[model samples]
Target: MKLHLASAVSRLFSKILRLHYSFFSGKILSVRAICTDAENRIYLVRHSYTPGWHLPGGGVDNGVSVEEALAAELREEGNLQILGKPMLKYVYLNVEGSRREHIVLFTAQVSQPDGFSRNFEIIEGRFFSMAELPPDLDPACQRRIQEWVIGEFGAAAW
Candidate 1:
């Protein structure tokens, strides 16, 4: 079922707030991948419940392996199936929302990308040429693309 953005956000924050009130000392791990088509375009998604376009991925739930989490997220968010084993790219410390959050990044070739239709969780999904990323791309998401995809690891403006 398609959830309204406010409703989805409420559900998410409600769950997290529950944990926040409890005695918790756990790190949040999320998986995001640089999934490229055969033509070398990267698949990015804009969520119905969130702003900005980003690489297709999500949080790894308990009892699920990191790779499995990535696969499932890619499938759900982009109608993508990894063509082969995903290669570990990098792990980023995402300090925007919480100190305990970490993002695991991977790279993979994918298929069936054309099947991605707008769904409840996702507003849109498509492959983007590196030279033509959207203006509203998340800063951190754009940074990862510049560093990892564009091979600009150390280019920081001082």
Candidate 2:
């Protein structure tokens, strides 16, 4: 009976530890722009912090609405105006176990070519066709992009 009690206690401790690890490891909420041009190219940014090309967005600020976060990230990273409403929202759990909730993705059209000088957090930015996406993009970003593209344009077409 004592041995069984000890095993149960051990299991409870393990479960608590797992929950603590999942909660306090830090979480980030990010917004991404699926900005498509008339040519159907999507704007992606090369991040200085992460070694991959990602959508023009970043961590959402505390107390800010998702739409505000998306707009702010777009202005800060891409230096271009987002002209429309958000088309999709994705929740992505990265490999590091950090959760990004409500990764608001906006689809907009840009007429002027804004200079991408890598300010605030972005290192480089450029537009690429779906087929020409960079190989080193973040896994979550890639998945969101693929899902967005498929939803906007039919899977058979894109």
Candidate 3:
């Protein structure tokens, strides 16, 4: 479908960007936002490239601050309008890949829902209750939700 094609293109674009940056920069920095609507439900997105549902986020472009990058990602991935300053939650050292990657997690409060449509980066997105999260959610994201929402964090790993 369109989502699959979009994801493939997204992955390809990401790979090219990574390749272009690898020759100049040694580390990669990204920002992620855990946004909540007026009803307190968490908004999650499924990337066209990734298999699992994840917090709405993307890589921080060069010369952009974490907050700036997060704001751009929130707008691009979910059409979310950040109402105020986002609280820094955690700094995760992502070791899932060969490159040195760091992700800055932020808790952001957003306005009421305006509905999300399928984009080239995000195929599907929706709000979910704490007790009924999707089974295919990224484990790291799941841990984040548990730690922030339920106040239970098992390990320090991400």
Candidate 4:
């Protein structure tokens, strides 16, 4: 009986710890590729869980720096070599109702790979001309991309 009680107490403590982490300590930081090719097309990936296209990136793992996470995500998702440093870092809330507090958007350039395979997390990836992009990208992603492009090209904002 003492052993069972001890086990129960341990389980209860574990549950409490998990709850605390989920509610207060959950953090997600990710690097997004703005991958622009020579023709100025932006690379976007389709997520397996969502309908709209998104930037190719994923959550940073614990103990990994942002740059390290970005490099790993780019290799895992796009199979392309990242060129140069990240263009931006962003912090935002998770729209899916998680306690995750941040997403770091790292703009990167990639040399188009001869071929690439999508992991189960991603369904497909392709480059889209700015004018030809789908209308339903994540609002935050679209805004960030637009701002970057405008800033890079010195385009007038209406």
In terms of TM-score, the best-performing candidate is: 3
Give the alpha carbon lDDT tens digit for every residue of 1-158 in model 2.
75445555656765675577568745556666778777878888865444688777666777998778877777777777766566654444444443423344556675335667654356578788878998898775676677775774222111
User: Lowest lDDT 10-mer window, candidate 4?
Assistant: 149-158
lDDT per model vs. reference: 0.79, 0.65, 0.82, 0.68
Query: What number of clashing residue pairs does each candidate have, in the order they appear?
Result: 0, 0, 0, 0
Query: How many clashes would you count in candidate 1?
Result: 0
Q: Give candidate 3's TM-score.
A: 0.85
Model number with the top lDDT: 3
Q: Higher TM-score: candidate 3 or 4?
A: 3
Model 2 residue runs over 4 Å out of place are: 1-27, 93-95, 100-102, 111-113, 152-158
Runs of candidate 3 with Cα error greater than 4 angstroms are: 1-3, 19-24, 151-157
Candidate 1 residue-wise lDDT, 37-103, digit = tens? 8988988998765678988888889999999999999889888999989988777777656567778
> Each candidate's root-mean-square deviation in Å?
3.8, 12.7, 2.4, 10.4
Question: What stretches of model 1 exceed 4 Å from their correct place?
Answer: 1-25, 150-158
Clashing pairs in 4: none
Please report how far candidate 1 places residue 43 from its true position, in Å.
0.4
Q: Who is ahead in lDDT, 2 or 4?
A: 4
Model 2: lDDT of residue 136: 90
lDDT of 3 by residue, 2-94 (tens): 656767899999778777877767888888878988778898998876689999888887788999999988888878888889988778887
